[model samples]
Target: MSVQVKDLKVYYRTLRGDVRALDGASFTIADGEIMGLAGESGCGKSTLGRSLIAIDGRMRYVGGSVSLDGAALPLDDQAAMARHRFTAVSLVPQYAMSAMNPTRKIGKLVTDLLRSRGIAPDTVLGEFRRRLELVGLSTDVLARYPIELSGGMKQRVVMVISTLLDPSLLVADEITSALDVSTQKAVAEAVVEFRDRGFVASTIVITHDLSILVQMADSIMIMYAGKPVERASTDAVVSSSRHPYTRLLLSSLPEVGVRYEEHRLSGIAGRPPSLLNPPPGCRFRDRCPLAFAKCAEEPPFVEVAPGHSAACWKA
Candidate 1:
């Protein structure tokens, strides 16, 4: 396995109480797999991605184990994780446009980041420029300030910088959310190119957009209320999702050939349950149309078919 997360639990500490962001997530990404994590907003998708790479303040590590390339990650220790941050694990966080330092030139910023990893800037300058070109960015971008670049340019720059050391696992959190439709396709393709080129051994693309996942992801995993509800190949999930939540989510999407004027588009009703002091059973019970008495108890996330898994009693 390229990445393995076993019963990982991460929560956020607030004055109200701990928000059970990641109750107990267990999954594995095979070598070179590009996995897409999709869900409604605040479904702990980003939390799961960030937990594997870094645990920020306000985020408490309740319990869990994250392993990359057979070595265990010190997810609870912030400072100790520095040894793995860029070289072994890296992140392209949400809002890539705003992630750059507005005060410094892009080149200087990259140099500073490389130096932080104990690397001399001159040593990787050649490869750095090449990567920028590979992403359709000009070498002149290195000389400009972040404010001077467009949003897509900034995103590409961040993508290059984040994976400069060729990390073993890449956590891309909503990397394509802020781009325009055209730029979105370009950026999304860039991600696939990154994977195909072996910039990272495997990648986890976290987004709420299922269409994007269908285009690029090898497999898709759906998350709800801080837990993984269903996982299967992209085609399998899109065509025949077994879990009620997954089926409802897929139904809500607008089909390509459908015209809204003639055929109506449906949406999933009801808001997601709050993670703070969430109900004991399935978090999606209240909203799941197929929910029954069996749903009163938590369903184990188990495999129901070859390479397919779901956490609903019906599945």
Candidate 2:
């Protein structure tokens, strides 16, 4: 496995109390695998992505262990974790377009970032420019400001910068969410290309869009509330969904060749339980269609089929 996360719990420090953003997430990604995390908004998919690389100020690491290539990431210590950021683990965050510094030129910003990581600027710039060209950007992009580039251009630039150090694991949060359909496909393909070319060893793509994951992810993990409810190959999740939540999510997507004039789209009902003082047992009990008395007790994420797992009692 390239990445292993066990019993990971991350909470937000709110004045009301600790918001249980990530109750307990556990999963693995194989070497060179592209794993997609799909869930509704505020379901903690983004929090899981950020927790893997770096947690911001308001986020508090309650407990968990994230290991990349068999070495543990310093989830609680920022200073120690800094040594790993962008080198061993990197994130093309949700807002990659605004990740760059507007005050500094592109090249200057890259140089400053390298210096911060104790890398010699002269040694890396040659490879850096070459990568820029590889991603369809000219070498001169380094001299221009972030505002000068289009949204897609800045996104491409961010992808290059995030992987410049050849990190083993990459967290691409909502990279394609803002782009048009064409640009979305292009960027999604670029991520797979990056994996095939060995720029990053493994990738965790966090998004609510299952369509994007269907295009590139080797496997898909479906999360509900703050934990994973189903995980399997892309084919399994799309065609043979096991968990009720997973089945409900799949039913919500529009199928090709299906006319919507007479057939109305179905939607999952009920609001997601609030993280603050969440109800005990399964967090999804209230909304699951197949929920039972056994669901009142939390179900283990066990394999119901080969290479597949779900946290539902009925699975």
Candidate 3:
């Protein structure tokens, strides 16, 4: 496996109390796999992605283990993780447009980042420019400030820089969230192309859009209220989802040629439970139509079929 997470729990330290953002998430991504993580807002998809690369001040690593390429990730210690970031595990964070420093020219920023990592900037300059060209950007981009570039350009630049070291695992959080439909397609394709070309060993793409996953992800995992509800191949999850939450989520998507006036689109009802003091057992039970007495007890994320798993008694 390229990435392994076992019973991972991450909490946010709020004035009210610790927000249980990630509650015992366990999964594995094999070598060369592009796994998509889809969930609604506050479902902990981004928290999971951030945990794999680096944990910030407000986020506390309550428990769990994250392993990349057979080595444990020092997520709780930023200084120790510095040795692994950009080389062993990398992140193309959600806000890539503003990720770069506006004051510094792109080339200088790249050099400083490489230098901070104890890598000689001169050693990788050639490859860097080559990748810029590959992503449809000119070498002159290095001389321009972040303000000089377009949103898509900055996003692609960040992608190149993040994978410059050919990290074994890459966590991409909402890379396409800010782009237009056309730009979104292009950027999404670029991500998969990067994987196909082996710029990274495996990738975990965190986003709420399932349409994007259909194009880029090999497998899809659905999360609800800080827990994984279902996981399966892209085709299986989209076409034959087993979990009630997954079914409701997919049903909410508006199909082409289906006007809401004629065939009304349905949305899942009820709000996601609060993570600060979440209810016992399944967090999604209140919103799940098929929820039964069995749902009062947490369902195990066991495989119901080959390569497919769901945490639902019905499944």
Q: Name the best candidate (by lDDT).
A: 3
Off by over 4 Å in 2: none
- Model 1, 50-144: lDDT tens per residue? 89888889899999798998999999998999899999999998989889999999999999988888999999988999999999988999899
Q: Taking the tens digit of each residue's C-alpha lDDT, what string does model 2 give over 209-255?
A: 99999999999999988899999999999999889888999899999
Estimated TM-score for each candidate:
0.98, 0.98, 0.98
Candidate 1 residue spans exceeding 4 A from truth: none
Each candidate: RMSD: 1.0, 1.0, 0.8
lDDT of 1 at 302: 97
lDDT of 1 at 80: 90
Instruction: Give one digit per residue, the lDDT tens place, for model 3 in 20-55.
Output: 999989999998999999999999999999888888
- As a TM-score, model 3 comes out at 0.98
What is the TM-score of candidate 1?
Answer: 0.98
Q: What is the lDDT of residue 65 in candidate 2?
A: 96
Query: How does each model score on lDDT?
Result: 0.92, 0.92, 0.93
